[model samples]
Target: MHAAEGLITGLCALACVTPARAGNAVQAMPVDAFLDTLAVNTHVNYTDGAYANVRNVGDDLAWLGIRYVRDASPGSGAAPLSSYVYLAQRGVKFNFLMHENITQSIEEVTRLNTAVPGSVAAVEGFNEINNWPVSYHGLTGIAAGLAAQREVYTRIHDTQGFAGVPVYDLTGFEPKQVESRVNSADYANQHVYPQNGEQPTYEANGDTWMGNAINGLKKYQLPLVITEFGYFSSPQAGWYMLGVDEPTQAKGVLNGYMDAAAAGVKRTYVYELLDEKPDPQNKNDGMHYGLFRNDNSPKLVAYAIRNLTTILNTSTVQRTRVAATGALTYTLSGMPVSANSLLLRKKDGRFVLVLWNETRIWDRAKGTPLSSPPAEVEVDFGTTASRVDLYDPNVSEAPIASHRDVRKISVSVPDHPLLLEVTPGAPPRL
Candidate 1:
């Protein structure tokens, strides 16, 4: 990967032992909310290499339970005329990247929305503008980008087809500076790739709040969109950021999603769905950034994500109105400094407590998993459960551990995400 393309997520890690903070209150969000925030980047429009060889993107996406992908507009000419129509027809939504020609972008999505209504997930401005600066009509650099951004916002919002669509702001610029300028968009955009294959919470610097604050993207008062972020599990490629193994990639990406959500990002699209080039020798840094290999083979990260989505998928309709419900409180103890938790409620009223430790687990220099004793975390909802289940995506779809009629459960965390299901028993009716 290029130096300019790296993502600095600002997730920090502490080496020494420090007690994880106890929650003052447990805030619960719908599981589907986090699932919807998870998205992947794709070069489906590019007709070359693995992208050219693989034709079952829709199938792969369905298997992963991922409904959205990031792609280039048809008019960009890097793609043939209407190349992504088939994928759109398969109920796949796309966040289209706008090329130089804004008119072509409008026309392309118009055609798409006409064929497949609501096919457009979002419209992104120029990517990594710091590296690939835009020169627009005598205007150059940030000035041109700002002009084009305002134009895109105006055109997208004014048009009937795109009136309801959200326009994400451009990346690779001073977000703090842009807030006062003409940064026109509904959502603030960011691209954060954690440094040195670090844990998603592992901050390169002393500041642990970087992932949440994230170069001041959170301060914009607009919903943050992580357009591009992921790890390339290639050790052969010599770069400043040391690449990790495939297992570490899986854990890091999953941990990254949880971290991003906890940080309040509206959406996160991991970079590139498939490795475009097949570097058998593991030489190319960019080639291995995919969840799938060039041959469309599944990586550990892909399976874990699949498992996660499958466990979260429910057949029940979404609750339109949130009923009067009690807030469930749970005591978390013995959590390491890197341990984190998120509470999610299923439509059926089951609570899913996600526990993961973001402590460093990959020895980048040795290219091996850093071995350490599993840290145990105990959680007690203070109410007996009628149904208790647990799932570790890296293991299998089925619950790897389970308990019933118990209010407390102890689990081990080794840089892995564990989902615990608790259907708290109802209070005794008078």
Candidate 2:
């Protein structure tokens, strides 16, 4: 990776332990209501409930990124040309779905360009085309999907004056699909999950994330934009941590993005800003992967994501908690890091550290996994920095070590780490 393009996220490590005073002041307020809190930050982008929530939540967010869909339904359906016009006029980017009518879809895209001129960010031709019977049915296969994506991208780029209109090929399938899509699409769109439904908690997906990312570099070497990634494992299981339930399925969705960022994939827009509604088509609660609840309240994962965005924008590496000497020891330097200065704790309670390397090599000899239902570890840090703790702010004010003991931390070095926290009066003093 280029020095500039090298992953800055890998090097920097964040101390999850924050002094009580450095607690997220916005925790008490509803996330939806705290939209103003992110306005000044450069990382957290906002979008009103695009496909679902009717409110223009973007107004309060920092960046007003929007997903414009020309398709009418969640599953496969006709391309809604009117939807493009509506979104284009609103100055939002359109996430184009590759539909049955490629030519008609192209025509609508042209009209959108003419309508909004240069307002669209990029166009996403299809979504998860690698899934069964969609675009990789063996009849069409991955090649056909690639051709379709390239065709759409070429047409848009070759337009009268829109030669550079970027195209995003979005997919969130396994490593096989990621390889296929990168070989074809103009950009990489990945979905993430810490583990398959079988695994316990947020354990890294191992070389799965790394393999796909390296594939992207080998094939197109194109820019990456993670279209849909969250904590959902599958359509059934979801992501959950501590006492807060975030369905393992949801965690699967998030793990993809986490994996992507660690692998140095850029420009990730978390799956859906709001929870998905009944599939106006299949009607089976099509993936409850919303950052916020139906009523616009934030989920535990949402806060995790919100803080993650903060960490990504400001800090570099995401620290996972591990237990050693009956104390909390964060696996800070094991995984890949792209930051310059790795910090443990600095002034103002912010776990802001510089990254030194793009890809981190682990010393497995130093770490050991705790037994199941793991033992607790106390993480000590000063209480003077401004830190954004990555957890469900709604969690109780219990002691750090006490809270950490309730669950087991995954010890898969360079793969996964449990992100924990320390409240005020809980800092480890020298």
Candidate 3:
């Protein structure tokens, strides 16, 4: 894990710890571990774009507590993407995409490591090769793509500077294309986009789109990586563009994070950290992918993420030897079909039960977020005898409500997530 972690860690969750509640765990993962799974795409090389337009790139990212970034490029030798250098010195890690120029990318990674040791999280191969077909020395289609991946994978492993770094493979291909590729990756990689302002794990062709994408890449038999997946926050319409209202974007983002983790995706990188350019007319899909606007002001998703990281963080509090933790035995009632529940364990021996309703709240026709009745989720944690604190990252990091001396609690689950933090008794008084 990086000095400051992200939110993309997979089910390495409990680290093989025996479950005290057996299989009663909902989404059993450590908070710090799950925070390691989250990352965002960036454009530090777009010197004239939205990323460069605002001078507070690091400030914004630090504000949101993001520790990793995936970029198509990391600027050439001349500029060297120096803007993010300061943050890299602190803790940020990069997963540089090598689809454009593998040799140049290798050099850049080597140079970056010299400046900042242990800054490379991963090195990736051809991106969306279907759209940008690879043609190496007359090789075309999947052949060239595979060959390039092989070269990069081998080179990265052979290069002493970053040999230990994992290599992610190409995406954007048919299932046939995926099947053609073999032995070229440590992780099977793919991209997913929930269309038409839908839920992050939106339904598609009788199944969740994410599930379908994961299945399509299952031939790799390797841990999966969602290299790109996000919704643009522009209030525009048309199912193809994937633009939704900001509120919907925020809700989908949180839902998508949990959905990806729940699906066992090794990591999920949201499309971007900042809009690439200004789209005052709300017309450009690429311009609105950022968690922050072109002017560097954060969107709703940004604030929501900030609150989330703050709530889940254990570094801010005193470090103590936490008790052995297992799954929380609990029952949730009145959860709607759209509702979802995720239970996360913290290294500090706390449990955060995240509850959300994925109801369609964005009316694209009206270009606004529609209000839905809150689901009164009655939660009964088996034999609860301590305090339970509730927090809504959409609102604030501080607990919005708390309960004491109660075995059951009721939470008004809205479209977004509400975390119920339960404090277990002091190990039954020794």
Candidate 4:
């Protein structure tokens, strides 16, 4: 059942799980599962009261292999220690920040980690350092701001013995700031607003939101977290990028993660779980980006996240072509896929061979890449062949596709499309 169906039955959520497919350019998994398999950390928004929700689902989520939690200034008197304890009891593991209140941030993180005895993870100095009004450095500039942050980060690490704790130094996409964030702290916590606070407009082709993260953070190779992401509706209703609706935001999350994965970013956390108040710009906003409504009922995006997590958390590897030989021959490696709504592509002259796998049933999903078992593959016989197959070593099944002797096979490409030709016993003539 699709995740939206759960909303109708009062199950609190619907889950979207896309099965693993073979030979595709893009792949996806759920946020939780994606983080877990990668052994990366995840954060839940404080606004959603997700502390309890995360606790409730902690065990199931643990299967996804998540280890740390960013409490977004929780222990600094914004919320209660019981909130931190709730997460600890669930086997979730650590904390991302205490509060920028410095002293409180340090004290609380220390207290929580000590009490939980290894559960309290790390503490961030504050939220986005480069963006936000409070972080404004004025004429001091990004370098000066980073230097200041380094001072703060160093002091926190040294004097406080907050030393062992992983300090999540965060910043905006500003190039200078990103450089500083990477240089200043242990983990590079980034906030990406791919849609630029606009509603998402879906097209027949893949959504643009998928490429934002790749373009935004491609330069850095540090351990990173997309701490916040959501569809921000513009103030003017008529000017909204996507009409104020659930489908648009749901699609945004999918496309956003797909883009992140395609860019090879392995970890991401959605902006918020709950939308308690309306955004200042648009009264109808905020609530729309949440996985759950203010009342705690799951939205379509929530289910999508859950099911995608199930797939990503499992023992499956999703990949993209960092370098391709051509439309048909290439070297592929795993990419960070957190959900199934990914578009995989290969540039082939005038046409981009792209695959759109909205539904992740690899075999059923169009554009599945067929594998040629190492033993059966030959570089001798030639008969212009376009073949797609999935070789299940475990099942000893012939390629999953029905085509036997490959000339050309009609296989659907979905969001992950591959364009290639394979001829047994055929060798390239240079």
TM-score of 3: 0.88
Residue lDDT tens for model 1, 258-322:
87776677888887688887788877778888888888888999999999998887534633232
Per-residue alpha-carbon lDDT of candidate 2 for residues 275-379, written as tens digits (9 for 90 to 100): 544333323332344555545565655554454334333332533221111222222322222212122331122232211211212112332122232222222
Top candidate (lDDT): 1
Scored by TM-score, the top model is 1
Q: What is the C-alpha lDDT of each candidate?
A: 0.74, 0.37, 0.72, 0.41
> Which residue ranges in model 4 land beyond 4 Å of their true spot?
1-33, 37-69, 93-95, 129-132, 135-148, 155-165, 176-183, 196-221, 232-237, 240-244, 277-284, 312-430
Number of colliding residue pairs in model 1: 8
TM for every model, in the order presented, reads 0.90, 0.50, 0.88, 0.56
lDDT (Cα, tens digit) per residue for candidate 4, span 1-430: 0011111001111112232334433332233333442222233434344434555335434533444444554454345666666667776655465333455556666666666666755555445433431332353444544555565567657754454666655453365335335547666655544322231112223333333333344456565555555553222233212223454455456555544454445455554545544444455644445555555565665555554443333331323222243233321222112223222232221111222233221111222222211211121112333333332211222333433355333433332222222222233467
| Model 4 residue 237 CA deviation in Å | 4.6
Cα deviation at 36, candidate 2, in Å, is 18
lDDT tens digits by residue: candidate 3, 150-222: 8988888899877578999866555553564455889888776766566655432232556666766776678
Q: Candidate 1: misplaced stretches above 4 Å?
A: 1-6, 9-25, 181-183, 203-215, 236-239, 314-326
Candidate 1 lDDT: 0.74
Which ten residues in a row are the worst by lDDT in model 3?
1-10
